[model samples]
Target: MRLGKTYRKGGFMNEKVKSGSRNVAIVGPYLSGKTTLLESLLFVTGAISRKGSVKDSNTVGDSAAESRDRHMSVEVSAASTEYNGIRFTFIDCPGSVEFAQETYNALMGVDAAIVVCEPIRERVLTLAPLFKFLDDWEIPHLVFVNKMDRANIHVLETLHALKAVSSRPLVAHQYPIMQGEQLTGFIDMVSEQAYQYHPGAPADPIPFPESLKEEEHIARAEMLEALANFDDHLLEELLEDIEPPQEEILKDLKMELGADLVVPVFFGVAEQDYGVRPLLEALLREAPEPEATAQRRLKNIKGDTALAQVLKTFYTPQGGKLSLVRVWRGKLTDGIVLNGIRTGGIYRLMGQQQQFVNEVDAGEIVALSRLEGIKTGDTISTEQQAAIKLPKAAQLEPVYALAITPEKRNDEVKLSAAITKLLEEDCSLAWEQHGDTHEVILWGQGEIHLQVTLDRLRRKYNLPMTTHLPQVPYKETIRKTVASVHGRYKHQSGGHGQFGDVFLDIKPLPRGTGFNFNETIVGGVVPKQYIPGVEMGVREFLTHGPLGFPMVDLAVTLTNGSYHNVDSSEQAFKQAARLAMQTGIPQAEPTLLEPILRVEVTTPSEFTSKVLQLLSGRRGQILGYEGRNDWQGWDNVSAYLPQAEMQNFIVELRSLTLGVGSFHWEYDHLQEVPEKLAERVIHSNGNGGNGNSK
Candidate 1:
């Protein structure tokens, strides 16, 4: 249960030799110390000479062009450091909820989390989702109270604020000692050591300030109480009014953390080095190693045994496809047959760099090169090991949808490939050929999600793509029954003559039965040879009726007709059928039908009244409203509205919530078109080359 120590004598010195590393995620709310904390980790571990400032835009993980422009992280970035001989690959993830799924995916195979938070109460609100994710997934995590150097900051007060929302115990392992307006240094509750810093000087152990002894004692006692809750032995000692030993406290912390029962909270100023050494020492000693992290279950290629799981994937020009994997059960080496193919080029990932390794063992992350035809979720195993797979990620349903098209006429293929690459990079993105609208639509979390994706398309693949609200798939149908009519066509020539005759009865069927055909012709008047021909003609005419849309839910019956014995033909019958449809359709009161969608919107409850009013104005029928957990003033509202009325609903909802609300929709049913609404739709469609209705 000891921390990551190679060997130790005469005080605790970090061991420098190890064959592997740990992957940790530095995550937090927007503008928090997430990126800065990662930079500090790299600097403290000597991975970089000095941490590059986000303001300077020279940081390793903040390499995206947009990140530099905004001086913040827009996505996840990876950087590695070797401290105490244990390699730690740190992933800095975005703080915005719009990008939460990105962070979740990056944690697929990481060992633990360092949830960074600021002192401002408002800024600390978003940490709930991140912490909830860890608890729900049973992933071990630690809270890092960042930005100690800021003026008017209270570390303990911030901790209490976060504690109110957190479900698990917030155990403070490092207590920062404040002196007037400066962060003097920190006190280690576990090791019972006091370390002080002088602005630009190195950290050194010093005597505990007697003036703050009372507060430090109370803080340490609280830490002990938190430990007792998670440890049975400590609880027993606490019941007997006896203090637990330091080794017992440290041991319990490691065990509870490895079991995902407790998260050790650390305090420090990421910009300065104050209070960081203790945090680093504790992490090296307490954080779970790769062996303790969740192992991805995947099957062997032969369906016999498995030794590996594909945790992440990267697109590489040279390697074609790179799968960053964690070997969990058995060994993997170059030329070893995996998934039935001869596996080759086993290597370890060092940041953006890769190095050839003889073999990859259980409990480490490695980037396998040239795994041709292997996908991101595949499992590779030894011929004798059993296959296992990890739980599938929760699919993120997109509330907003937009149709995408290439900017240039000739770039259609390039645009399609670019979107496919984007989908591969972010599975949270839902894309498909929208059958009703026949538009290539991309659905995402929000406006920003789509905007960022478009940016990446241009930046990564040199494809210019644009998005727009998709058009509703409206249909045309008949409203009233039309009388039967006879249609005949004939042509006379010198040698042969063509003639055909038929009578068609067009009637309105039910709303959704679509097109139906029946034949009830009397004997000899119309032969059976031209019945299908008449139906085929009716089918072609049904494609575009008076309103210029395919006709549906209509019953067409062949009642009576006469045909020449030698001149009846399919073409002649088709012409006769067309004439019958054109003559009888207008009389049948053909009308356009529009699709309706059942929509459920979730927004802060404070905006509920306004949202209800807005929906009502759009002809949305409100079903009900109910409060949702953790959304504060937010409520979930359900309603049904015409699809045409919802083209800009996503945009309107965002405006109502100030960019906090979201919604989802499904096909409800088609509703009869209102006269006024139908006029507008018809006018727009007529000018857009959809053909005009008489």
Candidate 2:
């Protein structure tokens, strides 16, 4: 196959001559050279005049200002290039686990993915979650072991480490030829052909290396055996010791890879352009086309009208809203109305750059301008379609939170609109006004995730923020029952002065019962109208207990009360009840109740003990731990942890588990704060004064 010539900006193929397109994602762990791989791919394809480095911060991917400042990708960057007459659009996804939602959303629309990673054994575990996602979605993918020039381990050793994490069988498509410590070339496992790497040019075909004959045979046999699991003819040929034709082997690889049954592994140094051309060739030949992907993704929905799903939403400073969508079924033209909203324009994206296009064919990812109300992971279609919706990637739950306040008080009015747009850009981020604390809490996957969000808020919306760990919504509950507490309120300066008297019984209820109020006033001792005032006063006081938090799990009863005919109004009775509660609660042994969460932490088995220790250090009560279902060599640990200890838990957990550890938590029940910690909390909250503290 002949490679296509340089594709200039805005020089897209006409619809009449267009052969086909492939949407592929470049994904892996941070610092694994995914962006560098993307730069090499675009450079070798002649889409760009020169290759840009991530260190220089000029790569086609990671072009956002935030990414440049951090020297890492904060979001998914889409770039289009043509290679071998096939229009290829590569989505460069963030490698940080914090930004994984960006990768997951982009993966939903792609035909195939290239899982890029390093050859380090210790870092192989970082690919576990990514591989699981690809397999779970049945999205065909192959592995590209990057940075081979710096490898400290043998190629077979790297493959062995990778296979432990991936559920699918890994087939070595090529074996690297190393000279001293440097990678000189690779031998194709299928064809048994050798190629020498050359800078700035295609690889030169060479004779098979006789020194590697035995090693190559072993690796080739392993690849054939893995493929034979799904092919009876190949199994028979292998059993009979017959050499299969190169075309037949390639066909088997293509069939098995497209079915998500096997993962073809290749090795190369992306920065030097070694082994990239062969990788591209494999994709062009073996990767599933858009039509096959479309049939698998949209099998349940039948439609001829244009069907597209918003993979990512962007709020460009200049262009306004750009909804990157994958066209699934029909053609999309400029100004097409989808889901009752008319598109402002259509363009293909090259990182931050946009090239205006009049129309886009199905199976292509292009940005639709000014799509209001459309969100990430939303399936959109023409109005004539039968209201079809495509399944999107699940929104990841937030595991970290911060309380944010605008630097300028006047910006509060604009906060809601800005955050709405922010959430549209990243559905994984969540914000809420805490009902109890009344603080604006921003939630996300981790600290870096929220920091990037804050940076975006400052740069895009001019809403600079001050952030801190969010306050735990604590509650105070009585530990003992107090009966027959009497109180009186009398005020006199002139006629019709306020005067009232009340007797109350307060008792502790079971945990989680909340506030309960009742009255057993007999013989009209307290007027019916005044009884309601008494209950209201009790509730008002409960909002801020003596411990400076909302009170719960207690019952207050108005047994008897007296009111003056003219001076004893409802207001007078309310004040009397407040006096009674203020006098009685102190004697009832009020204790601080902190919210506990049922947390299930998932980590690689090797780190399970460390995770248990981490939980125990945070006053967490471990329930048990067991192997994670369907996840080889991973453990799921369940525990009950106080919400106060969870502010920095994700950061620590990731640090302990090489940035792959994750957990899910939900509110459990309220438990008493430890005695020493309770003192510190009360002191921080103004020593049991009127207001709560974060």
Candidate 3:
């Protein structure tokens, strides 16, 4: 690749102008100044006249109502700008871990990403997951350490902390020059030149300072050494004590960074726009174009076909449904049919506002209105019959859940439609009507994540909801066996009389054995036709046991009964059977059983002890703990915990792990609830009224 001709006075030029475009995503941990970096980039590129502050909530990126109210990004926001002649589309992705699904989804289509972060040493571990994702997918990325004005540690020390979490090598491209406690300038390692910063304007060249020459030389040598690992020519020059040309070094940086082999680090105070121009310059010169990224993903790209991938789905109060898509291959025009769905309208999105456009070219990210059945991660193409192979981002598994109901009973019907839209907007959200508990549960990455989604439901869909802790699906079962329980029913009327008598034997079955019924009516003591009624009545009675929960792991048998041939009927027999169970279950020693789940919590090894203590406090049985596969310095702690104990587990886990921990769990088995807790649950569930006993 030729690196000399790519640079221009105003902006860097592209080797191939497929659409004269480059797409990049800005991502990092929560409160890392990603939005500020985005604002600076837009302002420096002349896309916006003035910079916007996060507190003001007037920024172009975070335009959603929920985002404004929370003062954070809730979804991916896309904006387009042009530096010189090259068009650049920037996607400002959510930094919160809960909304990482949005970032991952958008990363699939972007050419490269700028990982923004702060200089806190302790919080650097939060970037580990993001780094792992970029490396796993081979997506080119560079890290920008923001909030440099407030940095307390040396830049090199901060880089050391960041290197611990990344699999790729860290290459520092710029070194900050500090005066007392403030960052005033930076040295460009590639050019071997120093520049002084002036607020609201570009940096100006200054003579190389004598005091910092040794530090600058050491930093530059380290950068060269990192790049030399992948370039034989560069390594030869370094070994021979020959300084390589600036162009050759630039080529090495571009090549290695684009191949996902090295991460080039930059320093800045994004709130003041320092280092933003140089970062943009590096992106234009080094970041891969859409064609290269597309080739890397699709593998077998037909240049003539119209291929687009939906990165996000939205429902507008006025526009109905809108899908944010990246046109990867060919042109997308209004009224074009893609994947058998007619495009209702084509639009270029600027935050929450839409600018109507006739069509959009390949490499451009835009929204398509009213495209039904198309969802996030879906690939759309002009040829309906073609099976286009495209890379898809992995979705996040929900870690927290809420049992939700409509605020007003009359909005129940509207709630379903609103939930459908909510799922469309956020792929990480999921809902289910639990069969056992008969409650509607909404699941997401964390508490705030689900809360933001709920807020959106009320704001955008006009469907308000209430939430509470989900009820555990508890069951009742007999502990002992009881036999020869007699029940008789007799009713008389003026014309006829009703009479029935029955004797039943109730017994306990092994755990997990569901209800069963049997009959041993020799010589037809009870009429054969009436036997079905007795069984039906017994099954119905078991649904609501003496403890007010469905009974399981027990069986009942009709051993004997007397019937009058003239008065016996199925109705009389059914009534008599119910009466028998009403008296027999209590005598058999019924008890409450609660569900247990096998939980595997993955967290930093440093927090394993705390996690174990947390679990033990919640009556959790520790099975084991080991280093998580494919994750460095992390452990997956496995345990069996009662569902009741898991209700608030996620909230506490995050509090202990700096909001970086997560867990997965599934139903393992059912165990009898301890007497004390069982009594509390029984009272809480209103089962005490039904004769719950120790």
Candidate 4:
């Protein structure tokens, strides 16, 4: 594949027009200055007249109202610019762990990623997951250590911390020239050229500093050694004490980066556009071309037919759906049919702003309007190539949930419609009309993720919602057996009188056995026809037990009963059965059973003890802990925790682990709630003390 042409003044003259595009994603932890870097890149490349700051909420990225309100990127924003002759589209991704699904989805389509991050060592751990993703997918990525002006540690220390998290080798592409605490300039490691920064202008060449010769030599030597690991010629020159040429070093960097063999690190203060120009120049020179990425991603599928995959989705207030898709193999023209859905319009995206484009070439990311059935991460192709599907990013399981209800009863009719659109926009979001609680629960990555979705619901759909912590699906079960309980129902009316009597034997079953019913009646005393009604009554009463919860892990038997032939009816027998349960259940010692989940919490090894303490504080039973598979310096702690204590567990876990910890959980079993807690729950539900049965 042809490499991207170098940048020249007044554009390329003799070289062929660079029609190929490079899709790169900017990602990092929260407050990493990704959006600011985007603004700087756009401004430096003349894509925008003036740079916009994220604090002012005027940056091209993070233009959504939800993002502006929070002053953080909550979704993926796409902006395209031309650096040199090559078209470069930057996908600015959210840094928050809650919005990682957005980052992962956008990352799948890009040729490379710029992992923007702070220079603080404490927060360096936050990039673990992101680095793992890039390496796992073999997507070439480079690190841009932003906010250098506020760096608390030496640059080498920051690099050391970052290296602990990434599996690949990290080579410093540039070394910072700091004066005390403030960043003034940087030295290009490959060229060994010193440059000073100027506000709103390109960095100018400067004489190499004599005072920092030793440090620069060490940093540059390390970079060359890392590149030499992949090139034998460079290795020979290094061992012989012969200096390698700059062009040879650049070639090695480009080749190693394109193959995802090494990660080049750069230093920058994106807020002031310091070190931004050099970062861009490095991207234009070394970042892999889209064709190289496509070759790796689509090696098996062979066709010239238009093929694309959606990286993000948007639902406009005008009731139109927009699918931001990456054109992988062929050109995508306006109004082309893909997967049986004809594209309504083709447009290029600059954040929320859309520009009409008749057609998009291969390797370009663009928005196609009114793709009704297409969703984020779905591969779209012509009918002949419909079978050619690309693997999408793994769907993130929701770690937080909220029980939601419409603020206005009239809006209830629109809730499902609105939430459907909301889920379409954010595939990480999920909703369910819960079977046990009968509540409409919205599940997402974290509190902020769901909040942004809620804001969109109110703003775009005009359906405001009232939300609260989701109720745990607690249940009640008996601990003892009650035998030979008798109940009678007799009512006199103008017509035939109602008369029915029943005898019941109720007992507790093994845990998780659920509800069971059997009849031991003899001589048809209760009559077979009325047995169905009796069972129905028992099940209906179980829907709400004496403790005001669904009853489980119990069985009831119809021992004996009598009924008058003329007065006996199904309804009468049902009432008789209900009466028997009311009299028998409380005597059987009904206990509140709360749902327990088997949770596996993954965190850095250093925080395992704190994680254990956190679990124990929440009444969790520790199962065990061991080093997590395939994750370096990480441990997975397994425990059983009550669902009630899980409402804010993620919030606490993230807070403790510097926002890098997470877990996976599933229903394990039902266990009795503590005596004190059970009492409080019963009283809070208005059942009082030992429940209404008493």
The clash count for each model shown is 14, 0, 0, 0
lDDT of 3 by residue, 515-628 (tens): 889998899899889999899889889888887788999989999999987888998889899999999999999999988999999999999999999999998999999999
Question: What's model 4's overall lDDT?
Answer: 0.88
Predictions in order: lDDT:
0.72, 0.90, 0.86, 0.88
Better TM-score candidate (1, 4): 4
**Residue 200 Cα positional deviation in candidate 3, in Å, after optimal superposition:** 1.2
Q: To one decimal, what is the Cα RMSD in angstroms of model 4 from the true structure?
A: 3.1
Residue 59 in model 2: shift from native, Å?
0.9
Q: Residue 461, candidate 3: how far off, in angstroms?
A: 2.1
Q: Candidate 2: minimum summed lDDT over ten consecutive residues — where?
A: 7-16
Backbone clashes in model 3, listed as residue pairs: none
State the lDDT of candidate 4 residue by residue for 433-488, as single tens digits. 99987789999999999899889988998888999777788899999999988888
